[model samples]
Target: MTSTIGVTDRRALAAAQSSPPPRSSAASRRVTPPRDALSVEPSVVDELLLVCGVIGTTVSDTDTPDRIVPVADCLNWLQDLQRALRRDDDQYRPISLLMAQWKIVPQKLLPLVDSCRYDTDLVLTVAKILVILTKPLAESTERAGKLPIETKTKTTEA
Candidate 1:
């Protein structure tokens, strides 16, 4: 009986040592490291820029010939959006409205959502931009049902 107990304890210890530690929930898991910049293809960057241009042109207030906005302008707009999101502003509404009006579906917006399996810095960059653009919309929608109209107007005015 003593020998059997010893063998059982040894087996349990060996199994514990051999197995990996249990993982946390998916929400608590660490994000995968972004791909290196040099490995990103130029065509991927260009495609991302093209999508940005389409969105920028759709949202721009100034007169753009043929409604074709420059890629650089789109990049600047993205940077502005990033800053606004950091400040927790409502700048997301314009971009959201533009996307709706232009019928730019998720499939056309950020290729990263569909192609993240391909490791690339461009994909990561686009993914971050999309997150910034969509987060405010998500938060606002959540609050819309809970907040009174007066409070909503006051928050927006601020």
Candidate 2:
């Protein structure tokens, strides 16, 4: 069945079918700004470092070190821990080597309540990481069907 198009619908259809304004060569060839230039916030490296520090301090079962060496050392230790965790096959051999190299105790993997300056900072940093990791996934989801589309419906009174 054919439906009658209202004035609003006609106007919208006409606008959609009309040709867009022509652009000059200079306007068309204008250089777009770099993506980095649009960013108004600090880089994620600091947040990543903070997260590494938090995880490192917890794994080391020691107070946060005053020097940068300890922090770097802690980061290495965390990497080792991650590798160990992922080593499902040949677990014994890898764990033994990790234990020998870092002397890590899996039992003491818990973070103390007062380990970091603030728990919220860790939470926020972790959230930032999650956002970064899931950005592509989120974009794909949006492309799939999450994007909004404008539509018009007509009503008739008898």
Candidate 3:
């Protein structure tokens, strides 16, 4: 048995027949921002670092410039996380956790953090990154502390 469209089902059926639901003029092509800020949980640090690790691995690639979206997203995530941590005085543990990650992150993000670039906002973000998680590079003193064994040592003997 076939039933005609009921009063309530008319618009719904018309909407279903439409290829794409009509959107208001207000719905532009702009990307909307995230719904929520970074979570307050401390465990978010691990996931953040994981994203850093992925960025680090691909950062050396030749096409990295073309992949700006993900890099921007990761950087924004970092900033969001920093803001969350700073809100809680006693819970701000990024310094030590980031101290451990300094070896992995800064080197990868170095390209984006360059202060000489034209983007002052990037430079500002770089400064914030330094304040948040950047640490001094580890030096190679193992080789630096010793001179070449074969070469004559520079003696200070008088």
Top candidate (TM-score): 3
Q: Tell me each candidate's RMSD, in Å, in order.
A: 15.8, 19.7, 24.6
Model 2 Cα lDDT, one tens digit per residue, 1-158? 43466777878888978968677765574443333322212223233234344554323326754322234444344444454334412212222222323322332222321344355544344344333323332222222222222122333988
The superposed Cα distance between candidate 1 and the true structure at residue 9, in angstroms, equals 88
lDDT scores for all predictions? 0.43, 0.36, 0.43
Which stretches of candidate 2 lie above 4 Å from their native place?
1-72, 90-107, 112-114, 117-158
Which tens-of-lDDT digit does each residue in 91-141 have in candidate 3?
223333442335543454565444235656655655675565433322221
Clashing pairs in 2: none
Candidate 3: stretches off by over 4 Å: 1-42, 54-75, 84-95, 102-105, 133-158
lDDT of 1: 0.43
